[model samples]
Target: MQREGRRDSWEEEIKENSSAVERVLKLVEEDAVVLFSKSGCCISVAAKALLSTLGAHPTVHQLDKEKEGEEMEGALLTMLAAPPAVPAVFIGGKLVGGMEQLMSCHITGSLLPLLKEAGALWF
Candidate 1:
């Protein structure tokens, strides 16, 4: 019984520490390019790939159904209300919609310019 209690306490501590670390990381990336995605989403994958190909290393926030709890869901909802979708990109704390919008910007030769304007890229 004592061993089981100890194990449970250890698990709780680990969870708390992990949450704290995540919060710290979120704050550390001041000019963050956040991609709210999930595994097995083709659009999200392509969006991430596009960012990488453009020489931008975005902080990918995988919102797995099993892992997303109230806090995360609430945050997402507050930021992007109505019909929440994957691959939602937030560049320097600004929401920049999904892959379709990205593709449009790319075709117009405007995406890179926008990144530069946002100071997210050094070119």
Candidate 2:
């Protein structure tokens, strides 16, 4: 049986994670394209480069540099149901998945339309 104190602590953790999720949601909404990333993460670097190359100006949050970065990253993974990874991309407030998914979209020729629809691209 779990002690009352233990249960309370668990609940607190959930609340904290939820709050982080909320912050991420707000940040994602602030731009047409947002990338939740870690500054030193190679995958994140690749993701940013890919978006830039495609002429999409993505607003990137280097979670590792934020106050609750690790927590926010964990919350994003949970909220988006994405793999545990940095460089989670959102297009017009919609989860666009990570690098692999983004590359797939680009290869399939669907990324440009999404960028344009999100107003990240004009032409």
Candidate 3:
């Protein structure tokens, strides 16, 4: 019975993980900009603030606070061609990467064009 219980629990976990992965996939394509972040992460805060300051109001998802955040994060890592790290930025249904990449785009003056292309910016 004990062994069976563990197996059952494992199966349940797998189901939940699958659901989380599906959710993550949907979320990334949900808006012109989607930020998969953690509330406690300063980098996440910075990324959001920067985007907001640039006049782009992105759809923010604090994965760490969600019931399936860990699973989603795990799925993100697997889904992306790069390593998983929060806050993950998705723009125009493309993985734009983390805070550094975002800032680089901003600094290089490419971010606005990308935003415009994605329909997240008009001005």
Candidate 1 residue lDDT tens string, 1-123: 986886676566446556543542363256556777777888888998898799777777676743543345344443443345566776766677777777888899978876776666766
Residue 123 of model 1, lDDT score: 65
lDDT of 3: 0.82
What lDDT score belongs to each candidate, Candidate 1 first? 0.65, 0.84, 0.82
Model 2, span 20-117: residue lDDT tens: 87888888889999998886889988988999998997998998899989888877766555466577999999988888889999999999999999
Q: How far is candidate 1 from the true structure (C-alpha RMSD, Å)?
A: 12.0
**What TM-score do all the candidates reach, one by one?**
0.62, 0.83, 0.77
Report RMSD (Å) for each prediction in the order shown.
Answer: 12.0, 5.8, 8.2
Better of 1 and 3 by TM-score: 3
Q: For model 2, what is the alpha-carbon lDDT of residue 93? A: 91
lDDT by residue (28-114, candidate 3, tens digit) is 778999999877888888899998888888999988788888888876665443464688888998888888889999999999998
Q: Model 3, which residues run further than 4 Å from truth? A: 1-19, 79-84
How well does candidate 2 match the true structure in TM-score terms? 0.83
1 versus 2: better TM-score goes to:
2
lDDT minimum window of 10 residues, candidate 1: 73-82
